[model samples]
Target chain A: MKTIKDIAALAKVSIGTVDRVIHNRSGVSKKTKERIEKIIQEHGFQINKTARILALNKKYNIAVLMPTVESSSDFWYLPKKGIEKASEEFEMHRISVNYFHFDPLNLNSFKDVFDKLLENSFNAVLLAPIFLNEAKERLIYLDQRKIPYVFINAELEGANNISYIGQHSFDSGALAAKLMSLLINTEDDILIVKVRRDNVHHSTIEDRISGFKSYFNTRKTPIQIHEVILPKIKDQETINTLLHKKLTNHQIKGLFIPSSKVSVVANYVEEHKLKHLKLIGYDLNEENVHLIKNETIDFLIDQDAFFQGYEGTKTLFNFIINNVVPPKNRYLPIKLLTKENVKYL
Target chain B: MKTIKDIAALAKVSIGTVDRVIHNRSGVSKKTKERIEKIIQEHGFQINKTARILALNKKYNIAVLMPTVESSSDFWYLPKKGIEKASEEFEMHRISVNYFHFDPLNLNSFKDVFDKLLENSFNAVLLAPIFLNEAKERLIYLDQRKIPYVFINAELEGANNISYIGQHSFDSGALAAKLMSLLINTEDDILIVKVRRDNVHHSTIEDRISGFKSYFNTRKTPIQIHEVILPKIKDQETINTLLHKKLTNHQIKGLFIPSSKVSVVANYVEEHKLKHLKLIGYDLNEENVHLIKNETIDFLIDQDAFFQGYEGTKTLFNFIINNVVPPKNRYLPIKLLTKENVKYL
Candidate 1:
């Protein structure tokens, strides 16, 4: 039943000193803080939340940086929905959010966006560090300013960010490997494809391919595996011809496309009437779902991209509003999608 | 960039009046509040979050009420784990949680626990409303005190609670029916089991049964559907005897248990060597997992009970801290579990 005033009186300190001690704020002397803490423990003093709400008034603004959604893919759209949900919930508490978008393929665009964002102040930030080097450089200023940031979809090493929310890329790849193994015979060859635009280095694809190779190697599978890298250019006919030649030369029984552009390979496979080959890909884009429904893509791995964005924003808000520290890393569960269960999604 | 001083000067009011208006507290005249709001809008003043944290120093207490884990068929343990995880996250925020337990079938014990909790003061409460009338009675007191309470597992009608975090019983049952149909033939007869203690009313179980029957009725299949209600105290021998009689009399080809005691039916089927019948059940208990792995149970419908508890507590905390209103009813997604996917869980 003891209040803050009673604790302050018992500890021979002002109410302001007691408040500072309770909030762990700088200004109160260590000796007075220790004395007040002892009395608070002895009396089991509790703060009345209703009274605190009536007295405190504050607002915050948060900034979110992520890739812009283009017509090619709508993956970034899910995270934007999550950020909007958080913004709506926190608006009553006077918390506002400003969004900044950068092209996933353009590192200079990310640097320019971050430079503009740093000019304005934010209470907190949530970002997807897609352009690693540029993002790391921008985070140095965020560290100096002590503006906490959370990472979604991709993580940066040795950054003192608040948290990271995304998938365990290696495990998801292993899961894809297992699903692909189910569709092909032991003697058949497997093809791994990586597609990228001209100036973009998709590191996530590399991680997934490594995971797929590690799983097959650990299992000691006898199937011959081939890696194919296609440049993002006007050489579509050349790439298609190469694909046809590879299909004719090596009786490829299975294909693993390590990115969201699985639809491109799926279209080629259908056009060539390669119905005997099994295809496993990533994400649930419109084209991918069509191929999956027709059984052209035997399996698709979804990383629950919606939750990554949702959790990322919510985690930052929790820290800002409640003075709580969120977890350092949050990994979304790897979800396997098949024809039978894709409808529920 | 304008501070409180600027707003007060522009509104021709004291800084204290500006502060009072911002906090929405009484003692500020309406005209003065309007003028201060206008100035604030014009200038876009933001409060210093550091000052708010300094002023607010309160510890919150939450109480959780649920059934104790007594039987090997206890799925309630999963939600309890979720509650513990929430407690760990909120510990530094000075949120303390007290647990009260009751037998799922003992209504009087539930009443006694509620009576004691009514005398104890808490900021919030999280409960599993297993018993309808008793829960309604306690909720009336919670409403009068204006203490926000959330219901988990089952919801009561006209409770005026903050939110309900659980599964939609009918949808869950429909999903179960879909999974069961996948494992059986068109002309096969299906048996539905509803198990309940003598003192408890199995509303959730009945809802599931209704959904299951509705699915078959809509399909207009030639398969015969049968229902059985058994007392909780029935011995394994008695259950086995009754099941043998029913199987011989009706030639049941598939069994769908609409309660947590699906493992009991699995045991009877295993002992009687009724391997020909397709079995589907609820929950991920040890016994059920064994049946699933051995292929006795083709599928198990998991409602993600862990998330129900975790999200329930997190929602309550978010409401308390941010003065946010949660959705009236939040239903967890129905997850389908099979032997092929059980390892991931």
Candidate 2:
């Protein structure tokens, strides 16, 4: 095993300089830090983590930003449960957690939450980053503050966050497509429902639709794909009208909801007596479970939302208590839920 | 949350004495310890765990005892994997672990392993405690030395271990009965096979069978429950003779192997071209998966052996590092595995 001395020798720097860079101390010049890191990586240098943790004796606080569970959707509730469990376990080690919530459909709600959290002091942050542009603006301030943050549930581009904990959006969509294919014939039409407020962009939902299209396209299946956008102010009556019109106009064989609004689609399907159509959607809420038990929804793709919060808090705790930087991205295992297994969960 | 001072006042001890007992310090006398504990329980005192950990600085070494995983039955493999993962994450701290392995079938093997581990010092111990009498004798030494140990997989009587991390045996069996009830009719005969080595006692297996029988017994089902025991030594002719005689005499609809030897039973059913016998067994190993995929094994009850190892190691680490005592017994979630959900796992 190569030691720190070997990297220092190869980098043409003093041992102290190498040590400073390795520990991420601020005094080392950027050029020297880069050179030392390159040499260390090339040599596969391994540090005795025990000694490193013993040297660092500071506690840390992590701020978490996520959507609050409301009457519209309860998908965020599971993740909150995970976060609370992690907080209780880590409270003993001087690791404090502060949670901030925003409305999923309102970009301004997210912006306001981010602004308040940035003004407060925190060692680290974990953000869902639902709005692309608003999240980008917050990332700039986070960069200036040099506070490491992790992305959960959604990803933002051009941000130097420490890690990401969520699902592979595209893969999840492809999984949904496969489940849909099992219930519907190749020539049938499928509708993809995207639910959001009128002026808000949902890139995560778009990613899922892209993945769904990609899978069907590769399979050479002659399945017609349609998209439906519902305004945030739309009630069940408007949704019912639009869905009934679409079903009557086209022989819609399957309905795919790309977000947690599956419950809305499920309720429409049940009320309109459209039990013949196959439905695949996201998350496990009370509304979705009723539909699943009744066999109205063929499958529900779960991203293990609870784990995102649980692992995010745990990672921050490990960094604070053990002085360790874990992997930059942690992808949770994708789980497919059906009626048979849903009861067990 | 009542503070330690309140308990001290009620017990007529100094605040320092209460603090020492709460932290498990060695200086507190037995009479004071009992008095303080009684007062604490009466008031339902809860400690500020964060403050307690911050005030104390000490390292701990915990020893683990369990059966080694054999190729024939890889039941213990998952627990070992869980332990290894925890060890990697915890090596940076003052927590070190030593493992002692014994043959699951032999009582003498467990005694020998325990004797050797006792020679070396450990702050705490985690054991499977498969053999009740042998474990009782070994635990006497632990009590004399004032060492704390945890039980996993199985529990021993009259031994005051800190905690037990494993499944509730009866609940697991009840779950199996529910699954088996789904496959066969109430009038069909069911066979219960208890396979074990000659030297090993089958207390857990017996408890499982008792639970399985209780389900049918309460429902007043006409399903005939037959018991079969095979010697530890592998003899195809002997097993074949017993199986052939039982099958010829009765119209067996389901076979429930109350141990990890379900694969052997699965092999017998396949070899003899037996049909219409729904097989329910325990654990997920290479042999069992093969039979499960081939539709020979209908269901397998998984007690989450991996979590037993993971949580056991973590509990000991927390106790040593944070001066915390976990619950007396931690029951892992019982999972029912079938062909439908096996692929996802």
Candidate 3:
């Protein structure tokens, strides 16, 4: 309940002198600053946060660059909702966010939108870095300019990011393997599917598969494993033809699709009536949710994309607003959702 | 950046008159209030929250009632840490908490603590309702006084609470069942262990066990489950003797301990070197964490008991400060932790 005036009077200093000391302005003598601070600390005078924020002379602009929402996956909804919730919480602090959406599939679109963002004077950045190599290069430029950035969902390797708020991606892959081991039959081969266009953002996929393979080796399980990377641009029949041949040759007990686009395989299994195959995938998109509800996908690891964006923005905001840096690598707990619990979500 | 002075000037009213209208005080005339509100809205004005909170001359006290921390299980740390964190966050809001810890195994200790909490003039309560029947009786008196209370960790049957923030314990048990179905062999029997005394919190135990049993029945898994309840006061020798007999008599492949005292089983398993039995239990307690690290326990379901207390307290604080009522049952996510990822915590 003690004000700055009370502390100034107690310390036998002028109110303006006390204010200078409290705000760490250079004008105050070191002796006067120490005297004023002693009284302030003793009195436990908490600076009114609202007044402090209101007194801030300038507004903060945070640039959020992420993939645009499309029919491909509902993963975009998670971070969008997280950012929306944070905006409402941080509105009073003169913090505002400008959203810049980009096409996940097209590198040119990512560049165009990202270039537009750097032109504006933003205090910080929150991005997915789906276009990994370009983002890594840009991150160094951002570092030179002293603009803090955070990674959401996908943590690019060896970036100077303030923090990476997402799943421990490699462990999530091992968890998929753990779930797969439980759901499959003995002597049934496990399939690791990578549904992507090319080597763009390939490290993330590789880390996951490597982790999955290592788990089986650690357990010394004698299950045969098959690796398949289908072309992201393939036509339906071509995809079906390749999948049909794989399924025909191997006793595919359980399938592990280590990406958000699990719908592509969900379509293949359901269409072909591959009742023998148990499936494990990621994300909670509409198509995946539909498939899980129909009992097509056995288990969906919820990456909690919502909390990634929400916590990521909070970390950046805390640093900008309070000089409080959050943990550099904030790992989210991996959650497993089955048919029974998926309905409640 | 429009201030009250600017809005008051634009509205052609005194600053005090504008203040009355902004605070929704009774002194302002309806026509004058409407005229002032119109100008305030048009100017995009926000009420200074620091000034508003400063105007509140009273302090709020929230009574937190839960089980006392014992060396047997470090489960109490979760909610205590959560509540402590929330207290730090709400420290500026003039809100404080007083903890009342009770013994889980002793009903008399629970009653002694419950009676002591009622004497304080706390505006709100956050509780676990561990001693169910006695709590139900005491809640009527609390309701008559019109004090809002939120439940944490355990939601007793038919209690009128402001909100409940914890896991759907039943579904968590079912999830345990699903995991067990995957880990156990074709002929391996499952063991459900309840480490407690005298049914002090029996309903919670029964609900979890029933849910676990029903999952196997629904899935038509030909896995027979055996239930055992051990005395809380039994000597180490007695516990070892009983456990030795149980394990020796049955082909127990997987053990499910729904409570935080998975240490009882973990101790027996490690000491006996029961390599064949896989274990699943709850919390991130030191004992559980140690066990999980050594691969003594296979899986630990993280109920995030910290968030239960923290979110539950925030809900009560929001209702008291802002008249905002949160959801009645706020379910925390069921997190599955294995040996590979337990190191991160």
Candidate 4:
């Protein structure tokens, strides 16, 4: 372990200049900083993390922008809990997290919350870039300011993100297909149910559908895949009627709902006494978990939203403080949750 | 945020005495220790962990006893790597780990290793109690000496283990059965293969078998199941011959191997051109991972052996240093890995 004094002597610089360069303070000249960094790298000099952070004694403020947790569906709450956990653990390191929430359904609310978030000064940002276009435009400010940002649940295409911590949507979809293939026989047809208010689908859902079809493409015998894009996500009666109409015409043996709104389909399946249909969906929302426990849902693909949020925040902090560069895309394991294994997850 | 001074003042004791009690050093009187402990607990005083560990400046030695890694099968190497990772992370805390390996096949080698491990002074122990009776006897010596220990892969029924961090064998079996059920239709028959040298099966193997059976018991129409216990684990020809003899008599659609020797059966299955058979097995050993990649195995139930070893070491260190009492049994999640999701896992 080489000391700072040793590096300073080798670089022919004062210890204070070396310290400033190490901590990324602006006092040292560019050439001196580069020379000191090269020497440190050459010797593989490692600093004591806790002691170094204490010596610097700089407070970091992280801005977290995400969708508000709706009372009806507590999906967002899981990530919030994970972020809070990270916040609590990092408090001793002088890291504080300030959260700004927006309505996921309302684009105006997203803009308003993002504007409010930009008004405040933060060392870095952790966000779920839901509205892609709006998020892309607003992220330009972060790039201009040279503030590092991490994406949690969703990501902007070709954006300058430090890391994207979430599921590989397409891979998860393929996994769901594999599970569904096992659940139903080769002769059985499957239905891809999408319940949302708008016709324009998110890239994640579209990618999942594509991934699902890609899996079936590898099969020897082609199985029929039907898609039902319902306009009403929250209106259970309308969803039930739409699903009922689709089921009557086609003999769908397995149902693949590629969204957190899986509990709705599970409810419909349970109410209709569709014992032959094996349902696979996403997320471990309260209702989804309950349905899984009751065996209404055969499988729930857990994206590990909690880990995405937790790791996203930690990634930003580590990058800003320790200069640890995370992978461009950090995919959480595509966890398959059933009645037998859901509790452990 | 209560400090040591506040705790000492509350207990009417010197800061040194409070420190002794906090570090569990033999200096404070019994009554004074109890008084200081009560005050600290009542006030919810949390000492700064890193600073406290630095103040103690005590080097902890942990003895790890497990099976030696055989060159032919690097199954044990995964856990060893995990332990080494933990060892590297905790080096700053002055925690050192000493490894002692035993031949898992031979009882005398286990005894010899145990004797050698007992010769050294260690603060704590982490072990995989493979030979139940022999391990039980040696663990008593550690109990008498009052050294805390944690179990990694397996557990003794009535041992005083501080914590057991591993897969719940029975639950993993149940999870495997669940996955197998999804893979095969109701008409398909399954085979449970046990590839081991001994006739008397370990409790973990038996538990997995029970869990596998228990899962089928819940189904409306029970599927026929056959068993094949081979004499040699390493003899590929004998395993293939025995499996061929068994498969000729029955229409086994799905195969479930309770142990990590699933790779052997996978090899046999592939050689025999058992394309209709859906195989499920345990662990991510090198061969098994390759087979999974090539699509010879349908599903692999990952026990997360690496996490088990890593967490066991961490549990012992935390219990000894931070006084954190881990749960009696910490079950790692039952992971279902397939060709699609294996890469992410």
Scored by DockQ, the top model is 4
- Encode model 1's per-residue lDDT on A116-208: one tens digit a residue: 999999988898887677788789888787788899887676886777888766677776776667567788999998775435555567668
iRMSD values, candidates in order: 5.2, 6.6, 2.7, 1.1
Q: Is the docking of candidate 4 incorrect, acceptable, medium or high quality?
A: medium
Compute the interface RMSD for candidate 3: 2.7
Candidate 1 chain A — worst ten consecutive residues by lDDT sum?
A196-205
Highest lDDT: give the candidate number: 4
lDDT of 4 by residue, B245-332 (tens): 8898556889999878888899988987888888998888889989999999988888787787788888887767765446678888
Q: Fraction of true inter-chain Cα contacts (below 8 Å) kept per model?
A: 0.00, 0.00, 0.23, 0.74
- Which residue pairs clash within candidate 3? none
Q: Which residue pairs clash in candidate 1?
A: none
For model 4, report DockQ: 0.58
The TM-scores of all predictions, comma-separated, are 0.53, 0.57, 0.77, 0.80
- Any runs in candidate 2 off by more than 4 Å, and if so which? A1-68, A71-73, A80-303, A310-345, B1-7, B10-64, B70-73, B78-100, B108-123, B137-141, B199-201, B270-276, B289-295, B313-323, B339-345
Tens digit of per-residue lDDT, candidate 3, span B1-345: 467889888889899997765543457777887787667556666546785566355689999999887553567777887888888887877887999998876778878898899978788899888778888888887877778889888778677686788878788788788788878886899988888766566555666777888899987877878877777634767778777778875678899998877888889999988878899998887888999988899888887777777788888877676544466678877777787667654
Taking all chains together, the TM-score of candidate 4 against the true structure is 0.80
Ranking by DockQ: 4, 3, 1, 2
Pairs of colliding residues, candidate 4: A182-B182
Cα deviation of B101, candidate 3, in Å: 2.8
Give the lowest summed-lDDT range of ten residues in model 3 chain B: B319-328
After the best TM-score superposition of candidate 2, give how far the Cα of residue A136 lies from its true spot, in angstroms. 17
State in Å the error of residue A73, model 2.
9.6
